[model samples]
Target: MAKRVLVKFSGEALAGEEGYGIDTQILNYIAGEIKSLIDAGIQVGVVVGGGNIVRGVTAAADGIITRTSGDYMGMLATVINGVAIQEALEHIGVETRLQTAIDMQEIGEAFIVRRARRHLEKGRVVVFAGGTGNPYFTTDTAATLRASEIGADMLIKATKVDGVYDKDPKKYPDAIKLDTISYDKALEDHIKVMDDTAIAQAKDNKLPIVVCNMFEKGNLLKIINGDTSLCSVVK
Candidate 1:
């Protein structure tokens, strides 16, 4: 089992059945899953995306908003999700610390690598908000960056899919699920397990990444416990 890990949750996952905004039941379910990890002595850090609320790249593509402004809005949306996650974790008696790259002091502390490491060491789950505090960056990159900074053993990307597939499983009925893949192969094949930037960063740091379905109960804990059958590992 990994002693420490960083889990990347997509903003859409937080939306649950509503397809927008946070869902109370979903939040509670996620909190329970996280609580299981905490109870098992795993130090966890979370990086949540803001695509459910606002996607800077998508907005910019529409030509209505500047990319810079849209990205900033997306970053703020991440903070909102972070706060909601913090509340959910705390409501379940899990101690958590919210840190934002953009420095929303009223809601969270400034992102400091050492401070975040300390928080994890103290058995507190640290939630990283804001997408690198900059435009033109995705939360996948942010998660990889935070994982490297905090020396997490591995980065776990929680997605709707069970694992990395050769093609879009939703669209392609014959899609093949990969049990394991190399970073080079992922990049070469153009697999959409994560953004290229994030994959490259993780590769450079020699950090392994596990892609799995978060909606499946106990899957996260299983992955941490060295179960790779249900997920795809990229190293």
Candidate 2:
């Protein structure tokens, strides 16, 4: 089993059924899942996307907002999410550290690689926010970057679906869920396992990416325990 891993949760998932804003119920559920990883004696780092509140691309679509500004807004959105999850994780008796890529001394510490790794070593869940502190980068890329920097064995992409499929399973009922996929194959086939940038980074770092459903209780643990039937592995 991988001792250390980074898990990425989409901001949209936080909205749950309502489809906007952070849903406390979903937030608490995610926290509980992270706690399961911690209890399993594995070090966990978390990255949550900001799409529920705002998306850089969508905000910039009208052409009034510059891409740079929109991306920054998205980064800030991720920070808000980071704070929420950090709090939820702590409320359940899980030790956590909220660190942001952008300097936010008021609520969290600045992102520091050594400090983050130290927290993981000490068994605290380090929540990474602020999206690489750069514009034009998605939280997916940020997740891969953080996973690589912390020397994590794998990066987990938590989604609504069970695993990566040939096509959108919601649209195509016969879509085949991949059991395992290679980095190059995923890139060439245009699989939506993650964005191209994120996949390339994981490929460079040789970090395995596990795609699994976040809402399903025990799914994270099951995938980490090498239950390939439950999720897809992108390496």
Candidate 3:
């Protein structure tokens, strides 16, 4: 059996057509991929971002509230996404666990690394949310933290683009994509793939990260099946 993996999905990926909220079609497709992985005997965990609902820095920049408070709200938003994803997974007959960094007794249990590992051991897909329960830390940092804690073999960051690029691929038609990159180079180039804190944490923990576009069919499974050329790997 392959090692357990932590997959991180961004909020934008959840936006199927209208560019916001949980898209049922996309959710079902993601759930199917996760189910296929589980069927193949690969342990899976997820860390989901809440940007589709509300963004902390953006809200604060709009003078809606203080940065810290807005970020907390963003964290709450993640719980909502987590719940939605959990439901999607369970609806497809996949066992799952939703662990949150913040304490919301009504929604799910608080994050405990040991408990998460135990769940993974039992073959249940664990969904990690709430962004470390701290302000100013992106969900990317939370994914790295959870992946490190769970001893995941790989940190799979599912994004809109296929892989890391010198510039925003959506905006720059001529942006160059890197198939394999060193963490040091990613930092030097100030790549928008992840925050410095997240990349640093992954590097410090010696965890390999695979960045791929989740929109592609079976892309997640392909990456785990040793298709290194399909995505960008950071070591």
lDDT of 3 by residue, 71-102 (tens): 99899989999999999999989999999999
State every prediction's TM-score relative to the real structure.
0.98, 0.98, 0.96
Total clashes in model 3, counting residue pairs 3 or more apart in sequence or in different chains: 0
- The stretch of ten residues in a row with the least summed lDDT in candidate 3 is 186-195
Q: Write the per-residue lDDT of candidate 2 for residues 1-235, one digit (tens) a residue.
A: 8899999999999998888899999999999999999999999999999999999999999999999999999999999999999999999999999999999899899999999999999999999999999998899999999999999999999998888898888899899999999999999987876999999999999999999988789999988888888889999
Query: Lowest-scoring 10 consecutive residues by lDDT in candidate 1?
Result: 186-195
**What TM-score does model 2 achieve against the real structure?**
0.98
Residue pairs in steric clash, candidate 1?
Answer: none
lDDT of 3 at 10: 90
Which regions in candidate 3 have their CA more than 4 angstroms from the true location? Answer: none
- What order do candidates take by TM-score, descending? 2, 1, 3
How high is the CA lDDT of each candidate model?
0.94, 0.94, 0.90
Judge candidate 1 against the unseen true structure and give its global Cα lDDT, from 0 to 1. 0.94
Clashes of each: 0, 0, 0
